[model samples]
Target: SAGLYDEARRGWLYPMDVNPAGQNAFKKDAWNKYRIECIGSSIRTWLNGIPCTNLVDNLVSSGFIALQVHSIGKNDTPGKQIRWRNIRIQTSNVKPSKADNIFVVNMIPNDLSAQEKKEGFSLLWDGKTTNGWIGAYKDTFPAKGWNIANGELSVDKAAGGESTNGGDIVTVKEYGPFELKFDFKLTEGANSGVKYFVTLSEGNKGSAIGMEYQILDDLRHPDAKLGKDGNRTLGSLYDLIASKKIANSTRPIGEWNRGFIRVNKNNKIEYFLNGIKVTEFTRGTPEFNALVAASKYKDWKGFGMAPKGHILLQDHGDRVSFRSIKIKEL
Candidate 1:
């Protein structure tokens, strides 16, 4: 319980599962000082001068603090005890603890942390506007089958056929060597994708042509089994390579999961699910070309080899929510 918790969001924004340092900082028979430093978007915590949590979020700017004692658990003794003392609060001239190399958990959707900003990252989707996005093969954001609310941009379910509803949306600008980060939540049986190298040149009859980072419900979506060797499954390089199984690399359906696609300056592409690298391949290589040549895109010359192209979000006619769409050019 010695961590950063966002009461407004009803979730722990830092030390998500376990913080070994924080756990070791606790003492059963001795009193220990608990410290928290929150400044703007940066939040840090410590116990007995040992760093516990480092986080960046903007959800709650101001709020009151309260104490709580948990109810006894099934295995607990009837009256296990806890206490607090010397509780203090400061508003002005509060010096934030210096940040270390510890990873920072960023929970604010559609926003970037100071580190991300310093690393050249910028919002691709502003979380509330479609200014930088346009419907595939169209001049504006689609008027149907898409919803923007509560800091999420989502596609509405319709016929469950690819591009039959709001169709696909693509970034107005193109990118080649870049790193993209997004958070996505899938409905049961949903199918969608984050595509790169999309040229929007294949006649626009369906989702824009691109190298897809597949987003699907592996247990409920048929497409998860349609492609060879799970290539169409979640976090895959869609048809070209399968997303390898990584321990706890995927969140449960209906929960948000981080999706990352890194297109290195050398044309090597990587896909990460929940911060775990699951797939990687270099474009235009013999191995990559051989995979493409045997997949659905075999007929498309120079598929996924474009020097630069627009980033796309597929509207496969299923509900899928996305946020925190940010990117950094390499």
Candidate 2:
């Protein structure tokens, strides 16, 4: 058993629970009851009778239940304790009534919820397969240099170079007006990006040309210092428009950060990090074309002119991972 904090910060769950443990919505150090109920495909859980997890899964129709206490370090409090009582069950097909106030966190990965599906959302990556991706410079998925495991798609670490080693990957399908959401994690000084409106016709070398949502450790990466006025910092439209100096809520390194990129039919593009709007620019506008004219991509014919293009995951030869990749067509 290792420390739980490291895994919990990355949204890992305990063996017996649908959601992460130690949430402590109830008063700390106070006695709290955890109620777990299963009704066919639906498994609901409560902390102190306050609903917390609502999961629908049939794969785990049965299993053993066990209590886990992660191993602690030598400097830890010697007598760290956990207490539980009233460990009883009713197999008579009964469940506690749902409370309307408490939020129910769905911990199941990549599966669309009823509400999400009704709202016209679909899983873009499906969390476990590379069925929708291909190398930006090639027609098939790369034979090597990328990894898909445990529901995460990641680029392997190599010599720090832009699309030089592993190359870049793109969605097989193109997008026009869409809303994309995903979770990303960064290694120290890692430089990667999520790009859209990508046309493989750009060139045979280097990263694909697109409007990039820069993913970076701005303070640690040298690119943060080289770009014009932080234009290449995280959340910016890489190398062209600087992300606004707004309040951004980013998790620490090794933890997951949510990314949101929305493009309306009008080409109003927005980039958000952890639900905070960090950058926005309308493509095809005079100001946009002007900025592109001065940026590094000016030489590429028809840059940012593609009406519809694929979404790309940059392989900058640095370790970066993406998960929960999803998109909603607008």
Candidate 3:
């Protein structure tokens, strides 16, 4: 049900969908054509030629299709129902329809759909291997505190110490002006981060130095209350800009949440949580410099201005799982 199309509103649930015409876009008391395209990890839907959903997921590679009437509320009539006519299913010679402007909700961990490949995205983490990662300030992936299994890479909980266990792990290669996407699942009261522009130049540190996409159980984590003006809360640009409060901005603890970061060639950066853009800022700007001056990293000159650097998965000594790590160099 992750990508189930909302016929009434004509949208998906991943990010909040906007329908300009709203429900008026639907034809009432009449038959309408519905088309669904399910190929590999790509799933798209259309209602009378209007695109509804474009999703990429591998959770259910194969499954039989079934239709059912939704349960009604107590105030509704008991006999109220839904009907299907001219029902058809195509399994042969299936091809995807023309592309639309809707966003794709990619959920297959460590993999990409054909469209994503055509768009120049590649897997950053191979899901089960550490071939492209190494411990921060070290030459190899940490021997302990990080676990890889069942298509998930996770850090173990250890006394709530920052980088005290296995420390942080970073990408072997550096990236510039790229788009990064990852899926994370956090335990209750857990903390972690997906960092970018991590130069690792600061010789002395607990976690590697970088701008962070803060991850925390905002309700339970003390760090959520520690930063100025909620800038350290989940989805924030750690200690810099606060992620905007909005609908579907985050998922519940233990549920998978999508984290997206895009850095433009002009130094503009955007952060997203669960497909919703939350924080945006430009590096090396006067406003950005002033914000940094007021934060803990103020003493570090040239902070977050690296032209290219490794991506980091922080070892904040909490159980947090990561998957579907991918990047597209822009």
Give the local distance difference test score of model 3: 0.83
The 0-to-1 C-alpha lDDT of every candidate, in the order given, reads 0.83, 0.75, 0.83
lDDT of 2 by residue, 1-330 (tens): 111111444332222222224244456678877777776656666676555655444545766666768788989978879886778977786764543332122335666656456556678897887898889879788887799999889999999888887689899999988888778899999999999889777575688888899999887899998779999988889999888765425677787787778898988888877645678888889998999899998887778878889999999989999887878798
What is the alpha-carbon lDDT of model 1 when measured against the actual structure?
0.83
Q: How far is candidate 1 from the true structure (C-alpha RMSD, Å)?
A: 6.1
Q: Model 2, which residues run further than 4 Å from truth?
A: 1-108, 246-248
Question: Which segments of model 3 are wrong by more than 4 Å?
Answer: 1-13, 16-36, 46-53, 58-93, 98-103
Candidate 1 residue pairs that clash = none
State residue 322's C-alpha deviation in candidate 2, in Å: 0.6
Q: Least lDDT summed over 10 consecutive residues: which range in candidate 3?
A: 16-25
TM-score of 1: 0.75
Instruction: Please state the error at residue 90 of candidate 1 in Å.
Output: 14
TM-score of each: 0.75, 0.69, 0.81
